[model samples]
Target: MRKLALNDEILLKIEKPARYIGNEVNSVMKDKNEVDIRFAMCFPDVYEIGMSNLGMAILYDMFNKREDVWCERLFSPWTDLDKIMREKKIPLFALESQEPVRDFDFLGITLGYEMCYTNVLQLLDLSQIPFLAKERGEEFPLVIGGGACAYNPEPLAEFFDLFYIGEGETAYDALFDAYIANKKAGGTKKDFLLKAAQIPGIYVPAFYDVTYQEDGTIASFTPNQPEAPSKVEKQLVMDMDRDYNFLEAPVVPFIKATQDRVTLEIQRGCIRGCRFCQAGMIYRPTRERDIEDLKEAARIMLKNTGHEEISLSSLSSSDYSELKELVNFLIDEFRDKAVNISLPSLRIDAFALDVMSKVQDVKKSSLTFAPEAGSQRLRNVINKGLTEEDILHGAGQAFEGGWNRVKLYFMLGLPTETEEDMKGIAHLAEKIAERYYEIPKDKRNGKVQINVSTSFFVPKPFTPFQWAPMFREEEFIEKAKIVKNEIRSQLNQRSIRYSWHEPDVTVLEGFLARGDRRSSKVILKAYEKGALYDAWSESFRYDIWKEAFAETGVDMEFYTLRERDTDEILPWDFIDAGVSKEFLIREWKQAKAETVTPNCRQRCSGCGAKRYGGGVCHEGQN
Candidate 1:
């Protein structure tokens, strides 16, 4: 490990110096002579935010459980600290020992989202490692990636040596044990990677060769090495509760984080089966932790952190079968402690509303609903399964229950969307506003505030709409304009506020989400042109991305705005996510025909979960 001369003056000059400092409680430290394998668990973001993530904490705890293995945390420094490090010539260091990241045997980065692509390259360069995998030789640490983004890692494949798809609880340990055995035999990095590639769920990009046809579609992806598997199967833990819960005692940050309170996951997947939702598909076979387990985790977390609020996190909290009982338990447990319990993803239903009323005082709380589409027909096409009456009835209940402010979430550019469907958004908002006025003037609050936030729909892998074309930026903006104008002209009231996400940004995201290995060049080039934090609206640069696409001779529109054939080979075809391609095709056909698939918990649609030998997931079972 290269050590830089410590300059106290410069350290004091940067913001959040604690981020650069390497000492924290509960951090692992093992002697170089004692440990056989050194792993750096990296989150491609800053310290305060990364430390709070449950995935990082779980892997950190799991890897450290092995006496022969030592794992440390690494995160991308903020722009202010990055400036200082560049000026001071300091390499990226681990948060535990202050050692450079290059010294570790494996640099395991968790890819949480597409926006963090540029940050990965920034961290690699800051660590003094070659940004591209091909440029790095035997001396470099093996680079691996995991997390939700690993499901579709084609766009960033060139940077990572391998990708651990799906759940990492079991696969990570299996790979580490293999690495430890290989390293003890004095094996080379390539030799160990070859051996690791043989393990299920580990995808080694170097062993695979990608060829594109004249039309820019993938022609073939062949494995050059015999040890590599022809196809990689994603890893899934059979039991989540028996696994690790590392969020019980989170690392308190010196500065405020994006979400400062404790978060307890009530469930793992969604049962609604929204076609446009990547999370819904990626996290299949909706699994809910036991209510008793959740309550205990919350109690322990609150006792340890003294946090004033707790967020019940999941793809959809309302779908949890025991949601009412869980919320009641939490409210009773924390009511005297003055800790407010928050449920973020609530559906528009009476049962969900009843649960909310039990935990929160309606007068003091704000409600949020994600109808997703404006009209019933559009909702059916997306498999949202939400009726127009559900929205109106839910809004009326909110107004009658004394909640004055409600936030509604919708999407603009869905597959097979029409102008009439876009106008229905305004109609829904106006109906909600009228519902608010129907309440007695004395019972009504000062004013009812309706906030409608719309975002462009982006096609994602492993979904029914994977072959669908995203609406062009101009088309999406025109639709947004229609929705905006209709809302303003109909409501004529400042109480209703309408906002839409930028369409160009969504187009770029679509390009990255479904891109192949060749797209890494565009990402690195864009990063070189100063594109970091594309997820944040303030830091997004459309021009830089366009320039990068142009220099690489890559047509962004071809990837984002072109409809694909059902028989076309997808970049993620080699990855088996437990859901069959036939099922996805069936769902796509059902979506186009406006047929709603029943929730799996209610009835099995033969989606292949039973093949794993587990019946439909329920409350008590793992």
Candidate 2:
């Protein structure tokens, strides 16, 4: 019998014992004694939240497919179980094997967002692992970070031994083989790290030394070790249909998960180059999975998991050339089985409205639109490529389709945003409400509920807006008030609801998103001062972060408030994200000129993903 860290008594006391239990339907079970590498894949969030992550699921399934690797799932315990485990001195364990994560050969934590820095620390502390990467020895698990946040890994460099930049599918096979060979040769941890740094996508922060100018800007960042490359190019899996594993039998959770359904990734990357979107820029040159493959994956996953619904996952679902075909196929195939198809990240076009009408309940469901900016001019500035006319037309179509509720997403504190632009958000919402009223009273399904939400935009690395300056908390709030006041003054006040994200969290995210190696001290200090689950508004302590910044002598304003010159070197400059800096700089200039550039599909802007000779560029040549 495998030894469980949590006993029966402890498990019984926790709210969801299923979260800690090892066995779940379709969860990979391997003989630890047989495998050479024990990989514990973790998402530094609650079980429900982590289980919903498709990337984690794909990686877990991929790793387990290797004969010599025993890969198991791990997630940060909820407060209830967390308290009991810490008090009882029970080390954190993987869900499949119920073995302590400390004993695992590799601990891969996916850093999808900046807010999870504290939770990463909590995971380490609970696992009885050293908080800092430097403090651990050969006996300790090699901590690796990946995902979107790993693109800008400076704020987290001190904690993770190495960061795997870019797509997970491209580099892991080489990584595992190297690890197994090193283990056989009885290599030291330093030796393994040096070898790991030799891999194309692997970035070992300790091998790089960063010097700062008197003004706290990065003066120079040079590689110390000969093995470590000066520039770590992000790995891109070009052939999605061939290389990508559409996870066939994802582990079915016994309890409810955030996304309690089979998720089929229809595509990777986005064609629309929204300037503020980090995902769009980082995941360059759009690639769509074959429709036949998607159908098979969807069928197998749903059948294995016995899920009631299946979601088509992608950055932009509507942009997928075969979206209609895929969605229709899913509906036709799963209709008899009573499996609903969830199509998110869609443009509110006529086709989308028609498809949505079939799958969703018109009364209960709310149609979501990410206008990104409130005004057309501002939309052009951000390269959103969405017009005000598109919003009204889409809303009208939805109203006609018997959808009453509409959720509109916008970003506050965008570069060069005016008070008029803020009011435009309300104007757009009000127009949507009016469109609802335009429908004949007898023809209408229900009352209109337009929810307008704004989040403060934090400039991210590898984006045209990377040099954009973030507003102070007060400025963000004041701008939000401009929209709120305009909404309240509208005739559709009752139908429209206005809400904005917490400015404090936005400020913190801005700091972390663009911070350098020096900013890692602030994160460490904040975690030491009891910062966990900073993503949750209720759990965030701004004062603690403030104190950490002060103590570390790191100014948050230096990261958030200052706009960089076009020629200045950024913290993430070394990581070649495939999207050229020259292209981004050009786009930035276009934004300033209020000139809209067409997407990759329309015309090649020469973003340098073409150099990879894949995705849209390859197809364009054909």
Candidate 3:
């Protein structure tokens, strides 16, 4: 029998009681005396969103496989329970044992998004742990961070004890062994951090020193201690199939998750090098799994989880070498079982129609495509290899294949964007609508529905756009207005519907994304002023962040509006993401010239990922 941290009366008061209780399908339970170490794996958001992350699921399964380590799950408690926990003086607890999280050996938080910085603070506050890393003694759990956000760990450096700079699978075993050995030898926390800092991909921020110039630009970043390395090389898993185990039985949430399906990660990275995309740059030289392995994994996962829908996950699903074969196998194997198959991030031009037609969707789903930018010139600037011909031809094929609804995605406030570029979004949608109308009346399903969505672009670290300038909130709003008004003036205006995200939120995200150590003061101040769930639009208060910036006297515009000089020292310069800074600078210059670089398959632009000696870089070699 299990004793819940929350009693029945408290459970009855919360909106979702299942979120607080631990028991769910396939959740690991271990005796405290048996395990040598306890790890609290957390995603600092609500349960549903955290459960949807495939990366977290894989790492959770991997950690639990070790007999000496028992990993449990934790999420940011919702607002209703958050207030109750504070008023009742209840400490944050992990779901598995319902024990206080502060008692764990390690608290590993997956830093997925920049907007969740405040939530990270909230997680610490509720855990009854010190907010700053320096303030905590040896009694506290070693707070570590990973994921894409770890690339720019400077913004959250003061809080995290250490950051794992790359893929989770590459270095965790070594880390775990080090932690256990350090404990057996009775090492101090500082002694352990110094030892961990020497590891290939581990970064201990306290062991590094940053000196800023008079203009607020970073002057130098150097190792404070002899044990720390000058640069932390990002760890990457070379062989996708052999390096890690595919998650067979992911914890099934009691409530419906954002992505309520078994995610089959077909590949690890992307071939497309879009300048504005942090993911494409950070995850370099895509590596894919074998089709046979994926098929077997899918079968086992379906049986284990009892999930009806399965999605093929990748940076670009269509770019997988044997996608058609995999899709066909899934269709043939599960056609009678009523299992739904989905392939996201597929290029519309590349045999996408055939794959979509074969996957028998009980309800016809909308065909979605991301052009990234509306105009061809802008696309070349971003190194987006897509063309107008490619989009129209694919949309036409989809129309003939029985999809009446289409969704097109684009970004606003990209570098070198012009008024004509903004209007081109509507023009592109109009062309797609005209293609849909070409179908005969008798053959048509219904009125062609084209939903257009545009999100404000935020310059991210480790991308070609890292040094680029971003637009202000009003500028972003005016750009969206231009696109909206142009759509209204179109010949096919009735067929299209337009939507855009909050510009204020984008400004805050941009600030956090490119910010450095000084930004931590603002994040902490804002959190103290009741800033939680900034990722959720309803809970986001832009004014609180503004006041924090004013009180701290930190320049938000210095991070967002100013176009940085290439020679200036950037905060994340010391991290080697297998991509050379010289190559990124070259790409950035090419973007200014509106020149396009071919994708990885066509040619290698010498981005330095070849040093890893695997993935697409060494595809044909022994």
TM-scores of all models? 0.95, 0.98, 0.99
Give one digit per residue, the lDDT tens place, for model 3 in 1-622. Answer: 8789998889999998888797889899999889888999999999999999988999999999999999999999999999999999999999999999999999999999999999999999999999999999999999999999999999999999999999989898888999999999999889889889988899999999999999899989999999999999999888877886678889999999999999999988788899998889888878889899999999999999999999999988988999989998999999999999988888876478777777746457999989989999999999999999989999988888888899999999999999999999999999999999998988788899999999999989888899999989999999999999999999999999999999999999999999899999999999999999999988999999989999999989999999999888888998998889999999999999999998888888899988787788897531
Which of the two candidates, 1 or 3, achieves a greater lDDT against the reference? 3
lDDT of 2: 0.90
Candidate 1 residue-pair clash tally: 0
Q: On TM-score, who's better, 1 or 2?
A: 2
Report the number of backbone clashes for model 3.
0
Best of the two (1, 3) by TM-score: 3
TM-score: model 1 vs. ground truth: 0.95
TM-score of 3: 0.99
Which residue runs does candidate 3 get wrong by more than 4 Å? 620-622
Clashes of each: 0, 0, 0
User: 1 or 2, which is superior by lDDT?
Assistant: 2
Point out the higher-scoring one by lDDT: 2 or 3: 3
